[model samples]
Target: VDADTPSACVVEREASTYSGNRGDAPNLRGPKRSKPDASSISQEEPQGGATPVGNRESLGQAGINPVHSPGPAGTGSQPVGQEAKELLLFACGVCSKRYMCNSKLVIHKRSHTGERPFQCNVCERCFMQLSDLRVHQRIHTGEKPYTCDVCHKRFNRRFSLKCHKRSHTGEKPYKCKECKKVFTYRKNLNEHKLIHSGEKPYQCSKCSRAFRRPETLKYHQKTHPETTAPRECEG
Candidate 1:
């Protein structure tokens, strides 16, 4: 949970040499890191300090370029240590703290990472990292930070915002070639294809009826007392 009041506007902004590594998610530190190129050196993390960049200049804070340290110049980022002239920039907007090494910087970056590492073992879905997964396990304890930009809708992740955007745009880029029926997105296209193909991939073990859509199949299972026809016949 964030401590800063939502009404609090940024007081000051500073720039420094602390663009932390972004190979992995800052919030979701995986059990093992993906193997990176040998020439590449992941920064350990920089010392802590406070160096302002600018205040209230744009829609968001100004961020320096981020990458792993190297031996010398001739590339985008600076070489390891101070030998590189490029100014290292690192700081957390939430708390006025700057770091040099990518490690500490990543830790600072975690606040912005909005990492949700926790996941449901039964569901096999991934999250930001273990700690976040643990915190989210409480969702099985009921907690929600998500808020709806429109009427009264809220969700846990930004992806939900993307899903909700469709409602406003009414843009369905995906379309069925056989029927020319447009859909919201690619996943919908796959689901829609089942309709024309008459492919009832989802079957209810509790009952004998088959369903083209997963949700439809789920709803049909409710009538286990007798053989009820699936309303998703439109599928």
Candidate 2:
């Protein structure tokens, strides 16, 4: 069987049957989110911080096209042969997110199931996919395969290298709808969204300080004597 072939025959059958009734189809991961316009993204020099911009040239290169996205959130209907591919696709029951590749769907299913089939031999930390395990292994092995072409900094994962490349290219693909701020990555925008909503999900166990982001909460917790005692010795 081809490497891309679904390991399970049952999933292939289910995906094919899923196509019979589009109305009954569960939600699937759809196209990439639309980006802000190009004029908003262009900068003379790259800098840290999120901003809103459009034009998906950068995201398109990353295989996240807003137009051709395959999930339910797509703006238009699937392109030619996409429907058939979906029929042969595996979908997540929780989110109804579909994957054309069975392996991808299997890995995605782990997000819901919290199943970690892959584990690190050294630390015994678990991962949902073998690729993730391999990346985790890099920490123990001190292996950095991916490097930044500009600054020569190295990374264990290819995506990290890609994100670092943005520092050089000045690409900010994620944007905020309210303040019109642009972000180099989507997670930064998500963190920024909490500021506007005034939603504080990360709360300190000691001081009862609420934070929009976990990093902030973690930093705030350091002020408490109990948490910083161990780190003080390590340093």
Reference-based lDDT, each prediction: 0.62, 0.81
- Which candidate number has the best TM-score? 2
TM-score per candidate: 0.36, 0.57
Query: After superposition, which runs of candidate 2 have C-alpha atoms over 4 Å from their true positions?
Result: 1-88, 226-235
Residue 159 lDDT in model 1? Answer: 60
Q: How many residue pairs clash in each candidate?
A: 27, 19
- Off-target runs (Cα >4 Å) in candidate 1 are 1-138, 141-143, 185-187, 226-235
| lDDT, candidate 2, 1-235, per-residue tens | 7887677876878877888878887668776687867655575333563322453555666677667678666566555676565575677789988877888888888898899988898999999988889999999999999988789999999999998899899999998999999999888999999889999998888876798888888888777776445545563
